[model samples]
Target: MTQTVDLNADMGEGFGPWPMGEDAALLETITSANIACGAHAGDWDVMAGTMALATERGVGIGAHPGFPDLQGFGRRRMQMPHDSLRNLVAYQVGAARGMAASVGGTVRHVKLHGALANMASEDAAMAQACYEGALSVDPDVIIMVLAATAQQEAAQALGCRWAAEIFADRAYNDDATLVDRRLPGAVIHDPEEAGARMVEMVQAGAIITASGARIPTPIDTICLHGDTAEAVGIARATRAALEAAGIALGVFPGRR
Candidate 1:
């Protein structure tokens, strides 16, 4: 039997003339793209252009919705009511779906971004609210969740199509939460090191925490952050490493 997994990255994060990431170069390596939907870092032009690129690359398209915080880049967590959270997700997914359609593609999945994702990974109810918002717009849309966390729990409870994801360039704590970026060694920077770590985690069929503890879970996809200085390098290296290990890379079929 062969092992297969999806490689995804957040893109379309640049707003206006201030570009971010080597999107064109990175698209050559990833299997799926989580595009920002005019919230944290993208505007209409960015979304449309990105969707077109992802469509051309034959990469699976996903809506990467974050909190409405351009200044903080949605990394700073904000408190909001459950209804507000739900609306935020729905509106973003709807926008992404429309943009994808304009580019002759469609949003096949939804992945929460930044603080929204971090919060959801810790609170099942919060995750549920966000997923519910997405379902309201398109019940069939796949929800991508952080594996072995409250995000997973919420997805399970909702009985929606979902994929469990792990981070390739981020370190994980024993509880499976991502390490704070402010913390030492929280974000992995070396391409080769990031690639090697991904291979180990995929082979182990679990998230290997910073302390070297393994927490078993289904890994449907591995994510590489696109906003890093080494983003493209890490993406290519991770893909090469995975293929070298005889592990196939493909778009994930969300668990139904």
Candidate 2:
């Protein structure tokens, strides 16, 4: 039997009075919800409301932290000292955990968002900063990343559980990283096309990048970015396809 993979989505992007994605609707489809902390695109009310909704749906809760760049939505990288970055990540994770606990649940994992995650994947110094930040907040919270890069290895070495994540709604590079969004055909919005790509990856343990190259990546969790216009539809199709192909979807609990 093929091993099952979890379906996760980044959600809870609302900030202050500005509402973003349909988080409640998306939560119904995803097994894990990476709720945004106040850093990238969430505030107190947003976090609390999202937590309550996710808990009600029985979706696993995760802290989605990013650089403090609300304007760019944390997609634009910001250079900061290692200490500052660590402190910021820790603060965000702590806030999310507190909010989740208030809803009679707790954060199960931590996943960095946007530029912060991309930069930390290969940067040893930055990766350590984020990993330590997570461990400092909750030693047991699994850290999810796009691949098994140095960040993933470092987190494991520190006894922190980590999940190697892959995207079902986007193209990838030969290196197993996501294809640049600026490139043509980077985002897979079509449900059939996206489901086919994901089924191939989960069954064959490889993903064919937009450049037509096969990249082998052991993916434990698949990401479906909720901010996409077709997020809900794509998620539904992807889940149905995976189940049809005999890939059960659930959160990949790490060492903890």
Candidate 3:
């Protein structure tokens, strides 16, 4: 089992007027913050504000780019050519970098958001395209990818800096994909349940699927979705649980 891991959360998802998630509270609990770019949910104001806040908290900033579906909160899937997907990712990541720079922070990582991420997890070609876009912007930027999926495969194939990630608030399929949101028990709302599962999975150095199967992998970081209603509680609980188990939390030292 790894002695240390990084805790990250999605943030900066709010648009101009309507805010989303508890970024303030979640920042207090997480070591890394994945801020959404404009095409997905955040606007320039939100991105700049979130970037400044993350800088103040000394949290590692990540560029989170999703499909341009603000109405769907980037949760709705979209079909696009690989070239378009790559360009989309590049644009978002570039924006994130510029915003972070203005805020006296830096984007150290990149994470695909919503449906785009889900799709990438299943398609190496697609994942490769997004990653290529990010790398074009900053080859040193760490790609945080869903472990044991095509996302990871893409990163490894590219030989770029990357981190393997697992969810703290979501259940995993036996094949290592996330269970669909439409499915019952797909999203774990209880802090205790979420925290306990994280501890177990981290200790096992694998993803413990809903079917009770374990898929071995190096666990570099754990994700807690900030949009979840129980996000704050789950974040706190997960941090405490990992600490109690003698696993330190800090920024992930991305792998090659």
Q: How large is the C-alpha RMSD of every model relative to the true structure?
A: 0.6, 1.5, 0.9
TM-score to true structure, per model: 0.99, 0.95, 0.99
Q: Return the lDDT, model 1, position 43.
A: 94
Error of 3 at 108 (Å): 0.3
Q: What is the lDDT of residue 110 in candidate 3?
A: 99
lDDT of 2 by residue, 36-70 (tens): 99888899898899999888988999999999999
Computed on alpha carbons, the lDDT of every model, listed in order, comes to 0.95, 0.84, 0.95
Model 3, span 134-155: residue lDDT tens? 9999989999999999999999
Q: Ranking by TM-score, best first? A: 1, 3, 2
Clashing pairs in 2: none
lDDT of 3: 0.95
Candidate 2 has what TM-score? 0.95
Show how many residue pairs clash in every candidate, following the order shown: 0, 0, 0
Predicted candidate 1 versus true structure: per-residue lDDT over 101-129, tens digit per residue: 99899999999999999999999999999
Residue 123, model 3: lDDT of 96
Poorest 10 consecutive residues of model 1 by lDDT? 18-27
Q: Kindly report which residue stretches of model 2 are placed more than 4 angstroms away from their true locations once superposed.
A: none
